[model samples]
Target: MTGTDGLVVGEEVPEFSAPLVAPDADREERSLSELLSDGPVLFCFYTADFSPDCIEEWCSFRDFDWFASTSDVQVVGISKSRSWIHQQFIDYLDLQFPLFSDRDLTIAEAFDVRYRVFGLFERSKRSCFLIDEDRTVRYKWVGQHWLDPTRDVPPVTEIFEGVRNELGAPETETFGFDAAMTD
Candidate 1:
């Protein structure tokens, strides 16, 4: 499980800290390092929120509602929307995940998702990343920002079976050893 090409899979993921707003919190700041403390995380980036495709994509993640129990994976959607805007988006859509505001594109750039839209408009191309417990981006996909994300989360296998396999973390609670606390 390692980052490849421009994305690092086995190395430490680039760290960027910025203000983030959860469904209930205000303009609170959360860093990449902080988010990785608990375990793995899935980051879904798009042009913006409230767009038909974007909203539908979020709804799908919310509907799955399985990351909480299935793995250490926590889903976070990143976009140029303001924290307040994210709050409304989350509230209106009743998303059960966190949405991070990357208005400055710092986080987006760190993940190499930030770029000019159509070579003119500034925005993050629709992209998805699978970060391992060590914050390494083990999987990534960018392009087709307009595709129907309502269909599934990228790296679909992880969405269905959890990231333990992708990250090479053995199943322990049920398979035998504790997945976490192991080297």
Candidate 2:
């Protein structure tokens, strides 16, 4: 099926940033400018941290930890959840990735992913965007819990292969990364 770029292949990513959902006392902020400034970025937008679908999606990624290790991609889970709540969810689920709290819905708005889901309450849609090295969206996917995140998108292995084919790898390297090296 056709993806979010509409009909275009390469287009500038929608700009965005918001407060982090991590529960650390120091706290921090997330900026699309800052994130894409270094290199490729993958933004995974979920309704909330603890929802059944969100939980399953995160667990799928967690189960395949290698997605992060071998690819030149930066995976971030985004939601409108509060930082403290996000911390609890992460801790309870033992998620190793970083999640941002777009409490104000600024980032989601910019990305055009925030909207009213239940006809009464506005929530984040389950969407994913692949921003390339130049901060342009290369691919996009969005789902409203009709499918399973565990099977819908092949594990990080396929993602790595697709990305490597889309973007050239170093000449000396024989393969993409096999595990995520994050902080």
Candidate 3:
């Protein structure tokens, strides 16, 4: 069930699909169940691509060591940006994770994170969710305001800890940002 404010911990995320931009810049249609099949998934919903805060947030994810170390949990980002924009953002930041293009905000709306900025522009609130293979949300954090540095993104360390605690420790070593660069 959804919380009064939005999706809450323990609720099963609704099924959804979107165009995905892989780190290699390949684009394809991906569904939530398909993603969960690999393992737990972290869905980070940001406003748009290339904005200063967005750049910083994604860079932080790119630099976080835990993400690079883990193979059992997939970290994916979503936003209202188009597939091409997502590709550009990934290439520009050299992001190691896949991103979803929710151009119509359908995914955000399903998660109840869609909101209007200044009562004008429709955008997804900065939010993050850790959903297990069973599709149950284990952790959820939603930002309170737009452009508020204090609330724009959830703490990376906290997300790391949540993933560890919810999905168990990483089972295998994998390439991180540095490895991605050399390849």
Colliding pairs, model 1: 2-9, 2-10, 3-8, 3-9, 3-10
lDDT of each: 0.67, 0.64, 0.80
Query: Which of 1 and 3 is ahead in lDDT?
Result: 3
Candidate 3 local lDDT, 29-125, one digit each (tens): 9999999999889999997899888888998888876675667778999999999999889999888899999998889888888777656788778
**Which residue ranges in model 2 land beyond 4 Å of their true spot?**
1-9, 21-26, 144-164, 168-183
Where does candidate 2 clash, by residue pair? 68-179, 68-180, 69-179, 69-180, 70-177, 70-178, 70-179
- Relative to the true structure, candidate 1 reaches a TM of 0.76
Residue-level lDDT of model 1, residues 1-183, one tens digit each, is 111123555655688887777776566889888888877788888667788778776776665555434455677888898888888898999876788889888777777656664456666656677787677777666554253322333543344344555756444432222344333
Q: Which candidate has the top score in TM-score?
A: 3
> Can you give the lDDT of residue 170 in candidate 1?
41
TM-score for all predictions?
Answer: 0.76, 0.74, 0.87
